[model samples]
Target chain A: MNETQAETQTEIALDVPWNVVVHNDPVNLMSYVTMVFRRVFGFSKEKAEQHMMEVHQKGRSVVWSGGRERAELYVQQLHGYLLLATMERAI
Target chain B: MNIERDAEGGFIFSDVEASLAAMFRAIPSAADPEGSKAALDRLFPDPAAGKEAGLSAEWADYVRPELREGFENASTTVEADLEPLNAGEDGWTIPRDHIDAWLNTLNQARLVLASRYEVDEADMNRTAPYPPESERTLAVSQIHVYGLLQECLLQNLE
Candidate 1:
């Protein structure tokens, strides 16, 4: 309502962490997903392969967790590689 | 068909038959998601996964176009590389730099075909060597071929 209250709400929203998750796709190759992870997030080969395996064995993997804006950017990069990725506000 | 690395670390596919050449030429069109909503949705997925309507709308207006442009550019690169094949050549060379574009374009085509045909892991494993009797079967074959191409690029990339 008031400027101070609005500013407080905005700050609260900004403070909340968000997660970038990549979901499993029947079409995307494991090696391809691993490569995308390496390129987009600069993940190491082992780290990227670990997450890729998680995504393959499980349904999804939380590849990154941080500020909402960064999470959104990561999701954008993942989507650019045609991976099934999303950003969600962390509880 | 056989694939080998060129002197500059690029990939050269030799002995590409007419059918394989045809498949290479089809990459650009197969990557086009205009006619299939499923393919389009898979390519430009909602980053928020439907949780935030505002974010979804913002993504559609601001981000989707950029993504589409990137896909088109990759497809263009692949199409340009296939010019020799289009001109009745037996094979084409993927310069080291163009590897990413080729991989991306091939992936796009595979995803589009998979989405359109509802292909799953089972479909991918179906390698009976039977002649494709239906459109769906042909699409499956195409997906496999495109996937093999992607794998070839990845192996060379590594």
Candidate 2:
């Protein structure tokens, strides 16, 4: 492809959003999950608990949605805390 | 185990088994690259879902090293804190700053036990009592002990 086409494709790729999700697991405690959510995303107690509840009740929660790089970073951070987390391209 | 917060806000656990503290010290070395793959795999699964093999590989390549570093750090923190234990005192103190480290390490230990026992999510939560002397019963008890520890840390953290 030509340079202009390559540059345009790069920009489009960069604009595609990704969603960072945490899946509920039987092993992790609810409180531990809440604390991890607060620590990683800097969510307030209420917000973090809400997401924790969502994961508990709904099986998964979209904790963040934004640029792919940032989403990947968030997923990695969650995994570091041993949270079951993943990222997917936004539809 | 009995847990309470000190005046400085750090957590102290009374009745912590000397054996358990030794186990924490052993976690970092227990992560043998070959033997511990199954446990590590569960702890840090492929971040991408479905048939996205290429994406999963790319993500793993980028993230695995950092995850390894995190595991080492957690194990080190727990070891340092437990260094004072000499088999006499069945207890340990977790400074407020190292709470996260303790949480991560304890959770990892639980995951490793679950992996070793071949327990699924349902089995881990199975309230049905195993025969009292069975290894499964012992495994279940250990897992719950880790859960209680995590809960105590969370309560004090708040």
Candidate 3:
């Protein structure tokens, strides 16, 4: 591939936005969910609690948005914490 | 169960029931990917949210194996940490790095409990008192206990 072609590919990859979402479930405790959000996203307690509350009240929350690779990693980490997480191309 | 961060840079857990320790140890064995399908679904759900059927299938195909492997590794690490505890007497000290495994394992156990009891968002109020004769009494009680343990771990980390 030409240098310009590679650069264009990289730029497109960087521009693609994927959202990492966590959905509310009956089983996960609020505190535990908040902690997972903080641990995975480095969200402060207040920010984490805010997202947690959103999940609780609204049934889901978009916890993070970024490149597809990072979104996949975050969703995987959330699964490891047993939180319902998914990544999708951001609309 | 009570958990406190130790001077040695890990966390120590006390007041744990023997059965609870056994339960922690059993997580790796009990979390059979094939056998515990319902519980696993709750733990590692499909990410697609039904928006695009093809995308959800593709995502599951890409992510399921990794998620399964992750659950196995986390459960084993947590079991190893809890293996030495004598339950009622000896406390278990979780090394700092393995704390995530502990937290994940506890969360998985709660998922199993929730699955068993058919627990839903309405059932998660920690403050609600369970009816003594309710069939859900035992499972509900256990869920609260695990929640307390998880809270202790989270609080100490903060």
Candidate with maximal DockQ:
1
Query: TM-score per candidate, in order?
Result: 0.95, 0.85, 0.77
Candidate 1 residue lDDT tens string, B79-153? 999999999888889999999888889889999999998988877876676465888877887888898889878
- Candidate 3: clashing pairs of residues: none
When 1 and 2 are scored with lDDT, the better candidate is 1
lDDT of 3 by residue, B32-85 (tens): 445566776776687766875875687678777787777778888876776667
Docking class of 2: medium
The stretch of ten residues in a row with the least summed lDDT in candidate 3 chain A is A68-77
Report candidate 2's fraction of native contacts: 0.83
Local accuracy by lDDT, each model = 0.90, 0.79, 0.75
Against the native chain B, each candidate's TM-score is 0.94, 0.80, 0.78
In terms of TM-score, which candidate is strongest?
1
Model 1 lDDT at residue B132: 54
Query: Which candidate achieves the best lDDT against the true structure?
Result: 1
Clash statistics: count for each candidate = 0, 0, 0
- Show where candidate 3 strays beyond 4 Å: A1-16, B1-4, B14-34, B86-90, B126-136
Candidate 3 lDDT score at position A66: 83
Cα displacement (angstroms), candidate 1, residue B25, comes to 1.4
Model 2: DockQ score: 0.74
Docking class of 3: medium
User: How many collisions between residues are there in candidate 2?
Assistant: 0
Candidate 1: which docking quality band? high
